[model samples]
Target: MMADHENAGYRRLFDGDGLTFGTGFPLTDNRTSRPPVERELELAAHAESVGFDALWARDVPLYWPRFGDAGQTFDTWPWLSQVAARTDEVALGTASVVLPLRHPLHVAKSAATVDRLSDGRLVLGIATGDRDPEFDAFGVDREERGARFRESVDLLRTVWREDFPQVEGRWGDLDGELDLVPEPTTESLPLLPTGHARQELEWIAEHGDGWLFYHLPESTLESYLDDWREAAGEKPYAMAVRSDLADDPEAGPEHVHQGFRAGTAWFREYFRRLEELGVDHVLVSPAGESPEADLQRFAADVIDRL
Candidate 1:
């Protein structure tokens, strides 16, 4: 199914035999406001030069001070557009765009614009949203987010693939009078639905281009993938881990939130286990005081050998 995508991003990252690694943006452990823009660009360029498969950004609209982390502290479109400009070949992705919080038309337009500009290197990961206060702030009923999420996905696909498409839903309606401009580089932009988004696993498998999942233990993930394969069949599954790679090569793994703190050798064995569990790709968050140095070490020590 990944071969169905014409985009270089999907082809390079998901259409391969073994696992490929990508680093999440902000590339730092600084859970503060904005990350240094110049440093991010420089590190991104470094990531590309080292044969990293992709670079991912998160969409955090209104930073809930209570929630902390600002998610690269830059808007998804402009940040990714800038990332696209800085790197020539590495894939660009949104770890997710909260679809329930934004209008699908706006999302479609921005996505199309970026895809066109990037020469077909965008991979969109969509979500139903997680922050509760932010939902109230956006004036959207959190209870109805699931329905809205489904409707938004439908709207996005229709807009991208049809001319003057007719779409009527709880969100809004289009009478097929005016068509959207700048269609995606491919017939449809590749979409990976993050988490359940309040939908059934079957619904996700049936509707989404791929599945974007959060970190799980090895046993749990292996069993989950078995169920996923039954429903989704050849469609790819991607997951992320919040990792802190230790300086010592043989340091054992210590559990952390959603991931672990380990050395390069431990990570190497762990990733090989992930591949055996049927994980198609991984978004690795290199957590350290010096993110740039950590990333370089990760590339040279772990990824290059893998």
Candidate 2:
């Protein structure tokens, strides 16, 4: 499945035996155009203290008023660095960075910088840019994203691993003279492609360090996991679950936002079920009014039980 990638973040996550839980930023309420992040750092540290394994940040480049949700708001680099400084050991992740919009060399530097700053606690979840407006703003043709994504991903791996490595692509060429400094502390960074990223599963299985799939039904996820196992071996499989934790522990399941609205009891069982299905890690985006309280409750009530 996966090679022995020494990324601290990837190791802490996929290296474990059972399913592990991590929470994403905008810690609560995914509907706001601007998230109140005053306590976000505090919640992040608290989440680490409470047994959460990772802290994920989103890379929503622009706020589309129609969508009314600006991901974590702050640029992922500084934000992740801040989170890295606040927490000691939790793996810090980007839900998925839009690769087509940015240059690979920049990604290499930034990602490696964060990796060094955090002592290798970085797992990059990458994807082709999805929003059309984003494409237009970045002047990248949407149709070209698939190709650009592949180029960037390939280039990132090469640049990080080789010193002044000879390479050329749609982005540019690197002669054997110039090197990208500050190599990642590990052999290489962990690359988890989100969704399809416009590449086939086979491509992802081969090139990516792991996979970051979106939420899917149990049967569907099981089938997908089978395909992944067959193609990728034991490489870790991760997914996002939009959770609306009801106050009642016995609350039954109600489908919502590619996830569920359920009591702690149901959610706990659900997570265990996912673990049984061979899921390595889950990134949870909690929805509630009081994010800090909601996160703590979710950890104590659901994650703890699992």
Candidate 3:
């Protein structure tokens, strides 16, 4: 069972100095249209060998045609379990799991099982979910997901803490008072909220152990950090970026999503800038083909430099 480290405080899991680097799973190959899950694992193992801190996967149920890219292209739980068994030291994280779409008991059980198997090396990132098609297909109301996300979080926590816990919330009520067996190794799971998710910034600051932000320009990163710190008091913060690395060392910057398309040299410099701005960890998604090769090269060259 999880311990009682229930005090609300920001826990420093990754510092910018050591610098954790992670790549999304089932890495896409825009050039050849190949998804090399095995190649991705080989590269992830290489990342662990080189001292990259974590590996992340996304829970993308339905591929929305409008949403340019399909993330990871793997089921979240099985992928994470496979990665955990393959690697020994690197931490495992979900870029995020859409909380409102899943049952809280399932979330608690699956996450705890992975945590135990990983020997307490799981970092859970939760979100209210953004895809309209997924909500529609699941018969879940996108409009009410924010409220459901909050309730789901509460239920998961309650189940993790008390054996056969009874939960009453907007999502539903559990009356069995049945315990969720095999609790996580940590007293409380390390859950970082992705964006505000309909919750006020103050509530996010007060409740979230860490906050996850999407795209923010370099100029505004510091100011945003300041606002987040003000609301968060002392909690840590994390961010994700869609990056594509160029083979040409002299390649100029190209626009991706939250990140720039640059050579390894420029990527290294960008991470340094983030560290200077007090960003703790930056989860990078490779945007083009050769994600595995690019990530391997990144771990060997750019990641170590930071």
Candidate 4:
């Protein structure tokens, strides 16, 4: 269950001990080109109305031709702000923001702005970064990214939580001169670190409010959850999956990249298993031929049943 002290974003997705569900942006089948922005907003509102606890957007700063998929084709900050304006409830999240590529100060300011605009409904997911070409393109030393990642997280926390806080690190030096304007709805917005971020599990647990990782099988998930409990007891753990729902509700499972092609019956059992394994939240990409219909079906057939 969500603790009383956690902010709106944290509580909305994890307000209880059972599993909660959320979906990502781009709300359409066309990944090669831009999606219809208006339609995306409609689907986002629809998602909230149908009982999804949160809505996520990805941070793909540069569209690498080889990478082949542009995430929402919009920058994270403005896109989230637009989404925030359209929806009244439902927590807003970045599937993750690449901390190493962007300046921590800008990240802190933008996040706080969105958090305030959305009425304390932002859950910021930070990552060390993944794409090698992006690292080179940004002129950031890939080897030093881990250190930068650590530095950025430390810096962001201080700036958000303390007024005119003093800090010095590889990123830069701050001497309690000026504060970042427009503080978050809470003292600080929750930061959920994505994947390992080239740090020890212990370090992640100590610094992050929660953990966001890719999908895993039930056994692996249970193992990870055990480690999580030892490192950070009761701190929420979330995972993501890319799903393609089958037409038959009773159809069985077939493995795909980091997810599955399954039917409603299989999804229900799988989610129930995740709940048993202590997974606090699940972020899904329901990529059926008709995405809007898929979302509705998943909510009605799977989420409602759960």
User: Which runs in model 2 stand beyond 4 Å of their true positions?
Assistant: 1-4, 28-34
Tens-place lDDT digits, model 2, residues 61-177: 888888667887889998999999999999999988999988889999999999999999999999886667988898888989999999998898888877779999988889899
Residue 260 CA displacement from its true place in model 2, Å: 0.5
Cα RMSD to the true fold for all candidates = 1.4, 1.6, 3.4, 1.6
Q: Which runs in model 3 stand beyond 4 Å of their true positions?
A: 1-18, 28-34, 286-288
> What does candidate 1's lDDT look like per residue over 36-153, in tens digits?
8888898899888876899999999988888877788899999999999999988898989999999889999999999989999999899998889889988999999899989988
Writing each residue's lDDT as its tens digit, candidate 3 over 230-292 gives 887656778887667788865778987577888888888888888788788777765356554
- Residue 206 CA displacement from its true place in model 1, Å: 1.0
Better of 3 and 4 by TM-score: 4
Which residue pairs in model 2 clash with each other? 1-233, 1-234, 1-235
Question: Candidate 1: misplaced stretches above 4 Å?
Answer: 1-4
| lDDT (10s digit) by residue, model 4, range 110-202 | 999998899888998889887889999899999998899999988888898899988988778889898899888787779999999999999
Global lDDT of each candidate? 0.87, 0.87, 0.74, 0.87
